[model samples]
Target: MNIHQVSVNYAPEQDRLLIRINGKEGGELRAWLTRRLALALLPVLNQSATAQMTKLAGPAAPAASLDEQRDQLLDTFQKEALLRTGDFKTPYEDRQGQPANAVLGPEPLLLTEVKVTLMSSGQLRLQMLEKLPGSDTVRNFQVMMDGQLTNGLLHLLHQSLNASQWLEPVAPANLTPAGSSEVPELAIEPAKPRYLN
Candidate 1:
């Protein structure tokens, strides 16, 4: 399970963190997180507008209600998460082969499993792998953030991964030869994957 590339981003207003992952096996997974663990990112916003937001929304501020404070907290996460820029990479689609105005007709990729691995590099990475029908190989990917990780943040990560639909299969409506119930043929065709544009 080799990871090709990982792109992580956060939107504090919505309290959402997104990890866009690309795998060598030919698919992608987008992990969208929405919760309070994002507040752990205060240190990252020390110099940003988010810091000002927090100060203005202090506990004693009559105008700063609980919801308003929550909004400011989200800003902090966004300010922090947006610091990382990543390019999505994959071996599946050759953009040069695609013609202009070509809409995607391929089936959706299935997210097989999600896991967390503590790397020797001192980063706690989140890994998600996808599987195609009939192929023993799975498209695996892993990504981690480099920063201060709070307990609430760690729990949020665990909660987000556990709540996702990654455990279910996202197979196509039309079954291919590999998924057919018919008897196997003497010669088998290679799996040609198609993905959205």
Candidate 2:
């Protein structure tokens, strides 16, 4: 099944999920849910504050407590920043134009891991690990031409694309036409550098 539409929005604190599909065949709701779940999980995997704290704290302190505190702080900051930015709807409303027959399905095709890297040039690189039925693969995407960092989530969405080259398709041929029912085993490793202008 060809992925005619893909929409992903993620905040570090509150969970925001949204997806829409359209085509001759009625779209699968699970596909959208999976994308949302994957996007939501991105912050956790990409979090740098936690990593920085770990490096600073070393292996002696109670790592668990520090991790918990880090999560709490991250959540609070994310929420507050989102509110201040005022870009997203407080209560997310599903966008109009989704097919009527779309069914809400369970979440399984979601990415097991997502790593986001912020570069000096204000671009955000996203590396996603999606697990299908048998094998896993890493997909790389980028958000570029960013505005001031305060825009937070909205800024990322504004510049979102799946490829380093602005006009190229995000997923390669091997990863294209995201399967509706078939699940494959996927793994994510450190991705190569993708420049954003």
TM-score of each: 0.26, 0.28
**Which candidate number has the best lDDT?**
1
Error of 1 at 188 (Å): 50
11-72: candidate 1 lDDT, tens digit per residue: 45544556444446645555443333333332332333333333333344333588987776
Q: Please report, in order, the local distance difference test score of every candidate based on alpha carbons.
A: 0.43, 0.40
Worst 10 residues of 2 by lDDT: 141-150
Cα lDDT tens digits for candidate 2, 12-117: 2333233332332434332222344444644553354334333333344333687787876676566444433544333433434443333323332344545566
lDDT of 2 at 193: 100
lDDT of 1 at 98: 25
